[model samples]
Target chain A: MVRSKFFVSLISSLGIIALSVAWMPVPDAAAADPNTFNRLMKPPSKRNPPPTQDGIHDPGSIGTQGLQTPREAFKPLPPAQSGNYVDWVKAFDAKKIQPRFDSKDPKAKPVIMDLTIVRQVKGSMPDVIFPHKQHTEWLDCSNCHPVPFVPQKGANQMSMASIMLGESCGVCHGKVAFPVADCRRCHTETKGKATKTSAKAAAKPAKSKKK
Target chain B: MQATIHITKLRLLPVAMLLLVGSAAVRAEFGDIVLNNVSEQQGMRPVIFQHWFHRIRFQCRVCHNELKFEMRVGATQVTMDQISQGRFCGACHNGEIAWTVENCDLCHTGKPGLTTKIQGGHETKGPGIW
Candidate 1:
């Protein structure tokens, strides 16, 4: 009877130890499931604390510049689409763009530019497409900043021939930037007909433009 | 043995609660945003502040770490002489890395109580955060 009593006590103690271990707090060094941890990461409060400079996607307070910054400098010119390449480049200078916080943003909220292709200038507007992200990577805010960019829509009468002849994009396209030789680089085609036009001029422009 | 387990749990519960409260206080201490340093010169306070909003644009080396901006605000003691040297703001503001500080409107700004309109809606210049 004494031996039986001791065994019962030992078994009970072991059972109790098991229960204690089960009830103990689990260390949360890492999460078991990824999805659960994602939702769990949300701040405890429902209220979104005010936008910190580093908080939102927009580079806020950490800054802003007003029309004149409460100061004066020849009263900023009437904001307009650039009349010339220099005007366009100057406009790009005014908007100081810091490198982005989120690299994915350009791809996510992309701005699509309508392309106009022509057999030649003054011929037909050939519908060329300009990807905002593609151009933004190679350039800076000044690349298309002030009086260059009209505050409103339907501004800046940019010509394709001028751009091709080393004005705006041609500044780097034929030399440093992606060359104009690649037709499909900017245009889409049903069966590569435009490719022939692009190729014919490609080999010649590359050779003579350097001089 | 059972009593020991109960006591341990009870003790842990209060400690956990205290830790939670302590962390909340630290977050609240910072309030809204983290400002690096404030600059003052003879009662004139330019936002010598460096906020993270503009920091990540380039690297800290571009200014504080590389350009060697004094960690303390106004410590660099920027003057006309230094402006011409291409140090501090002159590093980028010298018509190269950035615009030059030659113009009165560029850095002096001439605004008495104007803040920047950047992330914080301050309408301040590029130097708001520093």
Candidate 2:
């Protein structure tokens, strides 16, 4: 009787152990790691994933399946590291993509303003050349004027901290535009040696400063 | 032997909890907007607006100024009727500029019962992740 009782208990215990092991959660490869959940830490290989694969779209949605992948659309466009991974300015220059200036009015033309605002930084960093040509080619004055920017000289108090926090230039730069990681792109004007763009900006009387 | 088994089960409890926490944080991307004002009440999934994709093609003023989409989350009370009538999303999604409102699943792809909020936190005030 004692031997039978021992076998019964051992079998029951083994069954319980098996059940518990089965119940234990399996580590999911797709699950976000709590330690590295920030979107900025997303792997470079995963950047600019297809609409279906990107978490933004519902993978199971029929619309997602019908949509073209970024890789497919960007195959011929110049590539970059961040945002949509396509150098939009370069792509526009190369005539690879012609984004409609106005969504409603197909014939609407963008108000292309040729101006540059040189913001002299306090440190060794080169002065930031805010080229209106590049921005105006894609955006409208109302997009930044009288709101984020006051459209007045020496009005906006910009800092790297503020920009990084998604204020001012941060509104577009780190999000849709090229990230702030490309430091030299903005800080191109060296001390006492104004680049051709900045020299032209300086030559033009501050008449268009409000713009 | 039974005591040892019980201890092993206890050790697994924390690991399971950690997995649950990790899964919860995987929902939203960088510029994703989850709009749920009237979705759950109407028995529809909340909309997940992909800002990055739209901004890729059009400038911010196209939506923020012309379309009158409020910069703040939940500020614009977008409705199906408004959309069908060619306001907000309908401005472009009228089967011409982009996809039409008939394609419900494309925009309204948020999981059931999500509240109206901008995922990845407030874009302007959130910690600089980039």
Scored by TM-score, the top model is 2
DockQ of all predictions against the true structure, Cα-based? 0.06, 0.35
- lDDT (10s digit) by residue, model 2, range A26-70: 545756565646545556565556655444455666766776665
lDDT of 1 by residue, A1-211 (tens): 5455555555655565555455443535555565554554423231223222122211222222321221122123222211111112222235333333223232332233322232222334333444343344333434344424443334545564655644445543432233455445444332334445563343343224222
* TM accuracy, model 2: 0.71
Return the TM-scores of chain A for each candidate in numbered order. Answer: 0.29, 0.70
After the best TM-score superposition of candidate 1, give how far the Cα of residue B12 lies from its true spot, in angstroms: 55
**Candidate 2 DockQ, CA atoms:** 0.35
Tell me the chain A TM-score of model 2.
0.70
TM-score of each: 0.24, 0.71
- Name the lDDT of candidate 2: 0.68
Instruction: Provide all candidates' interface root-mean-square deviations.
Output: 20.0, 7.0
**Which sections of candidate 2 miss by over 4 Å?**
A1-44, A194-211, B1-32, B55-57, B72-74, B111-130
In terms of lDDT, model 1 sits at 0.36
